[model samples]
Target: VITSENQLSFLNVTRSLEDLPVEQGNDAEGLLNECKEAMDHLYKADVYQSFDEPSLFIYRIDIRHNGSIHSQTGIVGLVPVEDTESVQILKHEEVRPERSDLMSRHLVAVGASSSPISLTYKNDEQLDKAITNCTSNEPVLMTEDSEMKQTIWKVVGETAKELSELVSNKILYITDGHHRMAAAEEALKKSNKNYGPLESTLAVLFPDDEMLVLPFHRRVGDPEGRSSQDLLKAISAVCEIEKSDETTPERIGEVGLYLDGQSHKIILPKSNGNNLVDQLDVARLQEHILAPIFGVVNPGTHKLIDYVPGPLGINVVKERCDKDSWLGFVMHPLKIKDLMDVAEAGELMPPKSSYLMPKPRSGVFVRDLNREKNIQ
Candidate 1:
């Protein structure tokens, strides 16, 4: 529960050692010291291995879950943040200041980073052929986790240059990790003492067509204490309501709603064709139902709402309502093209509107900020 009584804490242990410093202390100096302590531990354990030359890594990930399979092949390398215009990176979501500050402090303290900011671009035949040729051999390293299997191959010299050139000018869309990218930029501005490797952060680039996107469902509560019937009547004003046997939302412009013990479907009234952001299902739910009916001015910070990733399934939404009297609204995944369109137009999506599948693992490829050279 993300309620006040059991809120998620920023001071808890993190998913990787690189983030341990931020969890250890309250002040920036304390956090830096803790970060140094964590890195000292990593070095003492002799886990800080360095490659001899700058290299490009070909990484393959296969994810199997709930009778479904998802996979992708991409290259992991350092992304230079100094030339934002040249990089042509696009972001659809806005970054919060607190999260960006946390990321900046951690990077300055740890003096290294391995978490790759995921990016996607249009497919290129030459790049695909290069990756295929390199991955045809046995991987240099392979590992299996609960969610996915990761295989990596190292490519250097002229071959690395060839692969890098193929994607040198393409516009890269941020599929995930907006805060981390913002933090990288913030780290560059605030920590002038350490901008060498901080000038760039590690990233993984995949073909957009091959990436998987899943819905981010919402758990809405009646904080004002309205009855289910009253709420249903209120919702009928802006949407066409129909009782649905299906739990998950099947397509765009439609949402799956779970209230009490029954499932229902809600379709948006025709698009007014104004404000692309308003046409989004999540935005419509907020503008029409959450704001107008439920009085939730800001769903991102409201106590009456919670976001559930699609991987957890709608059954979890049903379970939450059964346990706590909260209503659930499951949104269909937004199309990638729509996301790109919003980004290109300099518009932001509603918070937690996307749940990208098969998230890349951390600590797979470390970039040492202390080193002057790039990853090799």
Candidate 2:
């Protein structure tokens, strides 16, 4: 029963994906109008609507693209302000205070959560067994992600008991939704006059092993008129560049540089980095290649180049390389073990470093974030 104005029609428990368009970036400026539209629609549809009290449920997303499809289920609930740092839950990314403020205002205005931040934890054998047992019966809702059939079950008794026991002693990590969680914290702080610590925030948790973390390819555009040769010469000063005729790079810690229609593998010397940050291929490229070669201390403001990830491959890299733009940088995939290590250390990766997959759909089962327990 939670959605943006564009999706109000589907808020009544069920609807088709084709029924409305997802709210896009352009809709941000029209917040008031969007809110008005949502209220108007709900007002007109009050005959079939109910909001007697706030509650929680489980949401599962099963999206399959090509031969890849994944199914995940977890309880939705409002996390208390204190639960965030109690080791019961964890965060993988850093959130900005300004962004949190913005999101808090939006959530209050909307009074609903349309997107569920994804949290993941190491799978306990008991939890896995419990989920399997719950799904043994028919699901309350069944849908399709492309051609993959997805199902969701509503748990309230033993299922919830089993799942709760499985994760009661576990630590959870946030895969996405830094902003949402931060917004909750900020809103609760600002809402002190009307809300308390347990004033309800939202989240969905899953097992880490079953979740997939993908690379987020970078697309650096408009390098402020820098030629490939100029950029290459700058890069050559930092790392070893292996000349190649092929446009795509094929190995880890290797970057495919496409400038002037030729490709080169900008490989780092084995002795380059000595610590965690330095050892990363992305950091290696940046330190030895992007920064030293192009005089860019900050990649975010770098005008001479842009970056892409391994998942996008070389084609996307090539497509973005312009005549005026000389260099295209591609990063090796971040291993799961490394990500886990980073999270364990309570550190953050550069923005959008990972492109996590099988992002769950919102509104399947909104966790009121005020619940006492999660049904498996």
Candidate 3:
């Protein structure tokens, strides 16, 4: 989550969108012009370096959490936008059209993409070996903070060609940046030119086994002023509820409910042997609890419901509840295989279902859309 402080500090440095000072009553077009001006200044000042030749990069991020270090490595490059239509790249989440439109405008205004859309694929021994070999040498760029360290290595010559070929035939699943992908498509539609930087989007492809998936907990407000007992009674009509000490569910079909300052276990009924989307815990929560009792049919746009990232921990939910008469549900993390399966089936998951960690940070590598050309 990028807090206000983070946005302010970032604006202070980049002077790019988000919390940057604009004229009073300025419209979207005006803000976009400001963004273009900021980007122009950045390019003029040489804030970004351009490579003379086509190249791929190996990006690795090591995160220290829970007394252990988890490392994920991937190849960063440009993925053809056509892959989405060809089904080579699959998306499991539905994006809001407004958000996608805004992103598309941003792409057009900036003419560059700083953050790479994250993609995941089935694990391959050869690909893993090649990435390991590349990382064996000293990295060309390294950045570190207290909890995470990021390293980048440039790949060129035959090795880059080999790496590209290895992933060419593999089906890619989007782990993040669904909006960006949608935005890229929208931008392509606006640009009548067939081949150029608009033909592709910056991406980082990681293997499924190396990527970490976390849960997105839900919290809902009681606008109707229903008591805790009344809410539990309504929930119990659909699911089996029992008092429990656990704040996080241990397995699928089980949900941890924090209501009235107490934790309870909710056991969901078995799903019918059809529709993989219905089998998801988040879907079940919507179908069983959020929709019926709270009348929250669309969690994405619902004003009373909000999502809390699992990495924030259960205490964050508790703190929110303490401030208001809100109830929280802790969800189990979705398995990587299940996500890939749903994407392969061309089905969408409920909003705020999964939180992928160790995301690639922006400003590490920037692609100049004006200079890049898609060579077919």
Whole-model Cα lDDT of every candidate shown, in order = 0.79, 0.61, 0.85
In terms of TM-score, how similar is model 3 to the real structure? 0.93
As a whole number from 0 to 100, the lDDT of residue 116 in candidate 1 is 88
What is candidate 3's lDDT per residue for 305-325, written digit by digit as tens? Answer: 999998899999989987887
The model with the greater TM-score, 2 or 3, is 3
Could you list the CA RMSD of all candidates, in the order they appear? 4.7, 5.9, 2.8
Candidate 1 local lDDT, residue 258: 92
Q: What are the runs in model 2 whose C-alpha is more than 4 Å off?
A: 1-33, 36-58, 73-75, 145-149, 193-198, 221-226, 245-251, 269-275, 300-314, 323-326, 367-376
**Which 10-residue window in model 3 sums to the lowest lDDT?**
7-16
Best by TM-score: 3
TM-scores of the candidates in the order shown? 0.90, 0.77, 0.93
Clashing pairs in 1: none
Task: For candidate 2, write residues 79-186 as lDDT tens digits.
Answer: 555567675666656776766766676666555555767778787777777776777777667777444454666666665666666666777677888888888777
Order the candidates by TM-score, highest first.
Answer: 3, 1, 2
lDDT per residue for candidate 1 within 262-371, as digits (tens), equals: 88999976555587777888888887788778878887798888998988888888888899999999899998777777777778888998888778776677676776
